[model samples]
Target: MLKWLRRSEPKEVPAATLGPLQIVKPWARSSASEPDVGGGYMTVVNDGESDRLVSASCSAAGSVEIHAIRVKGPALEMRKQDAGLVIPPANQQILKPRGYHLLMRDLASPLLAGSKVPVTLVFEKAGSVTVDFAVEEPGAVGHVTLRSS
Candidate 1:
């Protein structure tokens, strides 16, 4: 005997559609003097659902952590985001200067301008995404020396 057709059927999500996260305008500030620390900026957009950015890693640098700036009295201060960065559904997380950004400490070498810095971002839902950050001038702002065009 053959089975009858069902009234409704469940659908399975595709693997390609699982990765609905995107990274835009990834950039890192260049250090001319081979400083002990470096910084990077980017925008993480989640078009599907909520996710948590657990951690980050870079082979070129010693350590990687999420950082944010806070104004304390008459001065501004920078600190690590111990809880990690979270990405809400249909929302975007920004990583910029004087805000929620990334900290690259104990650099192996100076981040030269017009170069690329490869970093891997680990997400709880989306897994890991490896993106390259364009190196900009030491004191420059915006996406001036973007090489990942």
Candidate 2:
């Protein structure tokens, strides 16, 4: 006598529906013994076929502003970017310290190391993506540790 065995088809896992919005290398300033000025950094990649990234906001600090750090006459100056940052198609923009970054002012609480900071990023085209920034030691070298959702 012979027996027959049957196999079932494998189910497919759906892809992420949040199209084209990619976040990379996101990091927040390390916790300081005293509450001082700090900022956040990240890179936004827009892989979509069109332009995106109209604005960005966060609740981690009293107010989040998009600013640019420029070297003006041997002095570093941060200026508000009123027009907002833009992430063009297939391009990327960086938000790093002493440069284009998220100005986190009036920190509500101390960002302890080995902890996480909740940050919600809002985009005009891609909607919103929330991420937790890992806290590290102050004065640590910049590294790529965060990614987009």
Candidate 3:
């Protein structure tokens, strides 16, 4: 029956959720140098009441801020979202490249591939939810399915 030839299904990484807010496929880009800046990406799904992603923190970085890109006179600049990002009820907020993402500044150490970064996300309604973000290779895009190492 060629049982050994059967391909295995890719295992999906676990998502963290508190109440109606679920953090899916959280990931961060790998850094090659110390004190580097990085971006954190993820999708926040709200199944019940609306919530606001107020802030985030991690041991890997000194500061984390929610940022959005805007065009200004033939140039692109990153602006901090002072009011934070909103996730409406029954909706989702996707944090990706060139859009909304977590700006990690003053990195304590290089974030190498295959490592995981534990981040605590504070929401207005959902409270604080800590999730481990899988570190991917440099310039990695889209959701990544992690394999157990």
Q: Rate the local accuracy (lDDT) of all candidates.
A: 0.75, 0.64, 0.80
| Local accuracy of candidate 3 as per-residue lDDT tens digits, 24-53 | 999998534323878899998888988999
| Model 3: ten consecutive residues of lowest lDDT | 140-149
TM-score of each: 0.76, 0.71, 0.78
The whole-model C-alpha lDDT of candidate 2 against the native structure comes to 0.64
Question: Candidate 1: misplaced stretches above 4 Å?
Answer: 1-18, 31-34, 140-149
> What is candidate 1's CA lDDT for residue 58?
91
Candidate 1's C-alpha lDDT? 0.75
Estimate, for each residue in 53-124, the C-alpha lDDT of model 2 and write its tens digit. Answer: 555555657777677776556456677776667777786677876678776677777566787777777676
Runs of candidate 2 exceeding 4 Å displacement: 1-18, 30-36, 50-54, 140-149
Clash pairs detected, candidate 3: none
Question: Candidate 3 regions off by >4 Å?
Answer: 1-14, 30-35, 71-75, 140-149
Higher-scoring candidate on lDDT, 2 or 3 = 3
- Tell me the tens digit of each residue's lDDT in model 1 across 1-149: 99998787653322122388788788897444345567888887778889988889998889998877765565556667777888889987888876788878888877888999899888888999788888887762322121211
